[model samples]
Target: MSFEIRIARQFGERTIAAEFASKGGLTALFGPSGAGKTSVLNMVAGLLRPDTGLIAVRGTVLFDASARIDVPARQRRAGYVFQDGRLFPHMRVRDNLVYGWKLAAPVDRWMDLDEAIHFLGIGHLLDRWPRTLSGGEAQRVAIGRALLSAPRFLLMDEPLASLDRARREDIMEVIERLRDELKLPILYVSHDRDEVERLATTIVPIG
Candidate 1:
């Protein structure tokens, strides 16, 4: 098991919660829009802390409210890919990919800069800026940036939501490769039933 999550947070009158243990591979949070799927992903990524409960990944306890444990976001080593590829507007593709890589310590780093570029097939786009890349290309670069960080697990929130049908399929194949070839643990959040069915090994409903 790569994930053990049972957390909840209050937002005024609404309370967002999630409870599930991943059975390896890619686990998805499936639900309708506005059901707090992204919030749960944020909690896992340490961008948002749950008011109460535990969040453990790969046997490492990230947050345990009962124990008064809340690991810092950088220490969590969670790779997060947002719906839109949030690349640095000022940086070229190469710089963007290496930003996280440089932040990770040598021992913590698993993938090298060249390996990530080759894996993502973005070697040719190194000189290009973020605005110059296409949607699918930008997404691939985003994944590469996250992967180069050498995270223990990945949290993807609607990674394919902004793409067209053809581009979605392209990115889906890339994700499948990450799951099958790299064997990286992923917590994916999506509202599309078909996308969840195609990408997730275990489907945990949200809302």
Candidate 2:
């Protein structure tokens, strides 16, 4: 899916206006901390309302101030992955991965549970708790959960920020594989230049 965002919002006294568009593949939102990167993603995900702008994915109107259209967050067909991996501590890996699939309402369910387990190479870790898994493993499960939702667009915000060098590398490799293998459109938020170089086919430099 393609994306186009033209938004303006007030951040205290400063007026922040973000404008960009990407066709497909992985697009990196590159900028310093607190540069409205996450805000853009949130707007696209229908989590935040823009002051006056247009946000669309594959010609689908997500937010249009002119038309007074604002889709709810849950209604947007976008999968969001946070830095924290936000797995349910009380749930097992299997349960955590299937949570999105079991949510209210329904659409196309692309990623199968067993297929995802094999895709992320986490079959052996399904029975383990989040605490027992390493940082990379936890992130993989998080991504898997997002994929199982069958999102048309993926919004990932610094997903590998918490991992160590080795763990980050491991997860990055998996991300690369997902990009090429799945051929899914992604709006990846990150500050790491190397990660951008390795994964992004397009770049949106937020400032």
Candidate 3:
């Protein structure tokens, strides 16, 4: 599926505007902090209602202000990964990964849980809680969880922001593999120029 976004909104006193079409591949949102990179992503994910615009994914109208069509966030069918790996502290890795599927209404179950587990190299951490895993492990598990949701598009906001250089590189490789193997379109947010060059098929340079 593809994505097209044309939205305008206000952030504090400044107007943030963006218009772009994204084919199925990784699109990097590259810019300085506070450039409204995440804001644009939020609109596409139906997390933020735009003041005026339209958001379409594979020709499906997720938001169309003129038509008064606004699909709620949960129904957007887009997966999101935050900067901090927001895995449940007490839940085991396996439990956290399957949580998405459980919450999904009419879950597809199209993603093979076993395959996702192995792909992220988290098979060994399945029995462990989030706290026991390293930062890299947590992010990997988070990615796996998002994939298992059967999302049409994945939004990753600084997925490597808090990690050290080595850990960041490790996760980046995993992301590269996932993008190619799963054939998933990813909207990846990053301030690092190197990471953008390494992973992005198209760059949305903010600011």
Off by over 4 Å in 3: 105-107
Residues 1-207, model 2: lDDT tens digits: 388888888878876678888887898999988888988888889888889999888789889999999999987878888889889999999988988877734658877888999888889988889888888889999998898877887999999999999999888888888788888888999998998988999988988
Model 1 CA lDDT for position 28: 94
The lDDT of each candidate is: 0.93, 0.87, 0.87
Instruction: List pairs with backbone clashes in candidate 2.
Output: none
What clash count does candidate 1 reach?
Answer: 0
RMSD in Å for all candidates: 0.8, 1.5, 1.6
What would the per-residue lDDT of candidate 3 be over residues 3-113, giving only the tens digit for each residue? 788899987789888888888779898999988998988898888889999989878999999999999998887888888989988799999998888777565556868
Best candidate per lDDT, number?
A: 1
TM-score-based ranking: 1, 2, 3
What TM value does model 2 have? Answer: 0.94
Number of clashing pairs per prediction, in order: 0, 0, 0
- Candidate 3 scores a C-alpha RMSD against the true structure in Å of 1.6
lDDT of 1 by residue, 15-108 (tens): 9999999877999999999999999988888889899999999999999999999998998898899898899999999999989899999998
